[model samples]
Target: MMKNNVSAFVKAVSLAVCAALILSASAVFRAQAEKTLDQMQSELDSINAALSQKQDDYDSLNAQIGEQKSRLGALNSQISNMDAQLDSLNAKIRILNGQLLELNKQIEKLESEINVLNDRIQQALDQIAEKERQIEATKQLLLERLRATYIAGNSTELEVLLSSNDLSSFLTRSELLQRVAENDDRLIRQLEKEQKELSELTRALAADKAELVAKKEKVEQERTSVIVKQSELQTSADAVHKKQNEIEAKRNEVNKILATLDTNSEEYRRQIAFYESQREKADSAIEAYIRAHATTTVPSTNEDGGTAPQTGDGMAWPVPYNNCYISSYFGYRDLYNTGNYRLHKGIDICVSGGSNGKKIVAADGGTVMIAGYHSSYGNYVTIDHGNGLVTLYAHASVLTVSAGDHVEKGQKIAEIGSTGDSTGPHLHFGVYDNASGQFVNPLNYVSMP
Candidate 1:
């Protein structure tokens, strides 16, 4: 009887010892889980801080772009004004040129008329000299006639008649002498009148010539002034043209900077989204693991009530339709239209033709860790396979799965849509390993056509 009692006591002690061990292990697991949750929170805080800094940087760049645009606009307006001024200057120069040409024509006409007047003056001068010579000859002939008459007779005609041989001869000689004196006076008076007319004409022509010369001098001075003004305007126009070119070059540079800023802002937003989704998935995963391991045995079925994938590794194409092509590759990429580089963390698969609301399947059997929007991802979904592998499907129109819902490989989990920063209707598929805390290329795991 005593031996049977000792056996029962031994059994009770063994049972107590087993119960204590189970309790100790459970406490240790729970503590580790709590610590893991704390670490996740810390990581999320860090990511949030980084995201905030990125947002600030993005905002600052936008502000700078705005200022640059304003400056560019002002520069353009100034250049336009300068162009107008230059055009005005050019117009004035053309008018000045026309005026100068007319002035030159006037000067030439004046010079020609002055030359004609000079010729007229010379002809008048020559005629005046001839008239003077004729007057002197006529005067000399009259003087000689007077001397001959005096020498012929010292007394009057009566005395001369007394000395004459006959009355008839004396009468004839006296009549001849009177006629010669009358003819001499007439010729001398005519020569003096002709000489006076020629001298007056010469004076008139000389006055005209002097007036024309003075007018030509005035015109020449005006032309000189106009030329100087044109030169000044031309200098101003050239300076304005040079300034406009410089402003245009600066504007081009600013335009490029604005383009780059836009691209960088977009990239920062994408990175923030990626980090948010990661944090969300981590939270869900920690919760799920705690719940699963809390029990003695792991669940046989998936959280979505589906069997494990037949392909044990759970590697498969995310989309069931084979009519798609890889739109973007994973790595540092040259983004379209931006001419800038970006580190793309996922592969974008798109349909050949145009379509919307297409099915997006799970890449592998896993629990749906997250199904919500996180900025640029827009209606994002994260799936956690049991082996620390996670798949992300972004830009979904609709989510068919919820958190903790298990999915099989190739099962529909979401619908593709142009949400967030998607340029078109496509799915951004990504894979991450929690152990490494980094994304891996999906091609390394899944084979897609």
Candidate 2:
């Protein structure tokens, strides 16, 4: 009987030892899980910080773009003003050219008038010379007559007639003497009158020619001044044109800068979004891990109850309906019409009727790797199929799985809804090739029902 009692005591001690080991293992597992969660949380915090910094950078870039745009606007306005000034200068130049033309015409007319006056003066000079010659001739004739009278000793016409050889000679001599006296008087008077008239005409012509020459000089001066003014205006216009070209070139450079800035800002925004998504995924993963490990046995069924349709290849469509439309395809997408493209890492699914509250199913049987909320993905789930293939379902109203939970194909894992960064109720489904370390086209693995 003592042996039996000892054996029972031994068995009891062994039982106690086994129970202690089991409890210790459980405690160790819980501690390890907690430590992992802490590490993940730390990582999430780091990601959050990075996301914030990126967002700040994006904001700064946008501010810079705004400033550049303002500068561009000012430059454009300046260019407009410059253009107006150029136009005014051109108009002035044209008017000056017209004025110059008129001045040239006036100069030409004055030159013609001066030429005419010169001809008149020359004619007057010739006439005066001829009158002087006639006056000299008349004076010579008068001298000769005086000398003849002195030689005759003041003899009368009868004495002159007695000197004749006969009566006829005497009569002829008398008549000749009378005619010479009359001719001398008339010739002398005419010569004086002609000399006076010629002098007057010469004076008039000289005066008129001098006046015309002065007028011509004045017109020429005005023409020279107009030409100089036109040249100055042309110089100003040329300077303005050069300045405009320079400004236009500068504006073009600014435009290029703005384009580059816009591109950088967009890239930064995308990076921030990616970081946010990662952080949220990590957060949800931590929560799911905690929830899943809370119990001794992990639940195999959907945690958030729902029904889903199973349709497609080994990887099935994530949406409840097979007829769901693909709102966006996986690849580069132009979401903002900025002439810039962003990578769409997943396909967006929209169900018939209202997509909100529609069930989301796993594409294949796999272990849940992550189940959490994200700023970009909203409520999301990531399932790890055997091998390097993984599937993701995002933008859900509700998540029905936790990390570490086993999910079967077509199992309801979430409900579709508009969540963070979503435009409407839809499912963002993605396939990731772990081996390649890149998200792939989900359509390559799954087919439309």
Candidate 3:
């Protein structure tokens, strides 16, 4: 019996030593995991920052494009207005040309009239000269006849008295001679007056001709001005067209940049996908470890000796198997605080003895709120279980539920992954109180599988 007791004691001591070594190894692994998680979180933060900066750049470029487009539109409108003005100017030019042509025709007609008037004036002057010459010749002839009769002394008085047959008859003959001379003088004066009137008419016609020439010159100048204005309008139109083309080119450049950004965003999404797969595997391993090692009796305090609250609504085990281990724990942990600005709000679990791609079941029935990539959570899902309760699963390689979908307790919602701020395959599980809008330790609600 003593030898049996000794063997039992040896066996017990060996077991204790083995347990201590395992715990020490686990601590070392935990430390390594924490370090890895920190690195992942740092990279994730950088990616997020880059994404934000890219988005800002895109928005700024878009705004610039929009402004350019608006200016282009305004320019187009101005071009349209210019076109209308050009049309109006063209019409005015046409009307001016028509007026000029009419004025030219009128001037030509007036010039022709002036030429006829000049000829008439010259003819009138010639007639006046001929009349003056005839009058002078007649006066000379009369003078010679009178002088010869007087010099010859043809006994005019006695003859004249005998011819008259009385003194009174002789006196009547003398008076008639005087009246005939006066009538001849009056006829010459009338001819001189008619010549003067013809001279005045010629001078008036010349003045009218000069005025018409000046008006014609003015019309020509107006037509030249119209032509210059048309050229200016054309130049303005060309400038507007060039400006519009430049704006369009700028818009195309912005669009090209945005396209490139979209490609980068897609690449980031792919990286998130790959990491999620690894995280899921790690989570499954932890789950398996916890299932094998954890006792059935619920501990009053968690491993950290913190009493987590227990809410009755949908509180249950997440998995059916035993031997699962928590690879990470929740709340203000630095490992997942890559931004160096936020706390880690979830716990990581790995089924230490399970195969990869193991199913990660939902803790309770709920409606899926998210089932896709969250920049920080990676491939993740959130479920609103109603009544102020929400459950979150992160680093999932595959999700079986989507937003707005119903799920029952123990439903397989996703597979484990190492996505997002994770270094290895694991599950990041969280419980949120809808009332408080705060994260609560999920360890309070779910037991080790």
Best by TM-score: 2
By lDDT, rank the candidates, best first. 2, 1, 3
What TM-score against the true fold does each predicted structure earn?
0.56, 0.61, 0.43
Which residues of candidate 3, in runs, are more than 4 Å off? Answer: 23-31, 154-449
lDDT of each candidate versus the true structure: 0.75, 0.79, 0.63
User: Per-residue CA lDDT of candidate 1, range 1-449, in tens?
Assistant: 88999999999999999999999999998788756755765665566566567656766776787787898788789878988988998999889889889988998898899889988998999899888888888888778877886898676888869867898888887787678777788878888888888888888888888898899899889988988987888888788889888988987897888788778768866765665556556645544553443222222435543233324764788777778889888887754323345467789988777547888888878788668664456677888776656778988989999977989888999998987656788889987655445566777667675
Clashes in model 2: which pairs?
284-372
lDDT of 2 by residue, 1-449 (tens): 99999999999999999999999999999789767866876777678668767867877888899999998998999899999999999999999999999989998998898888788878878887888888888888789879987996898767876788999988888888789889888988887898888788888878888888898899899989999999999999999899999999989999999999988988986786687568657755754553443322211222332111122335676775766889899998655333346578889999877899999998888788778776567788888775456678888999989988999999999999898667899999987655444566777777777
**Global CA lDDT of candidate 2, please?**
0.79
Best by lDDT: 2
Two-way TM-score contest, 1 vs 2, winner: 2
Off by over 4 Å in 1: 1-24, 27-31, 34-42, 49-53, 77-88, 91-186, 189-193, 196-314, 321-327, 334-342, 349-359, 366-390, 394-406, 414-427, 433-438, 447-449
Looking at model 3, report the run of 10 residues with the lowest lDDT sum.
334-343
Every candidate's CA RMSD? 8.9, 8.1, 15.2
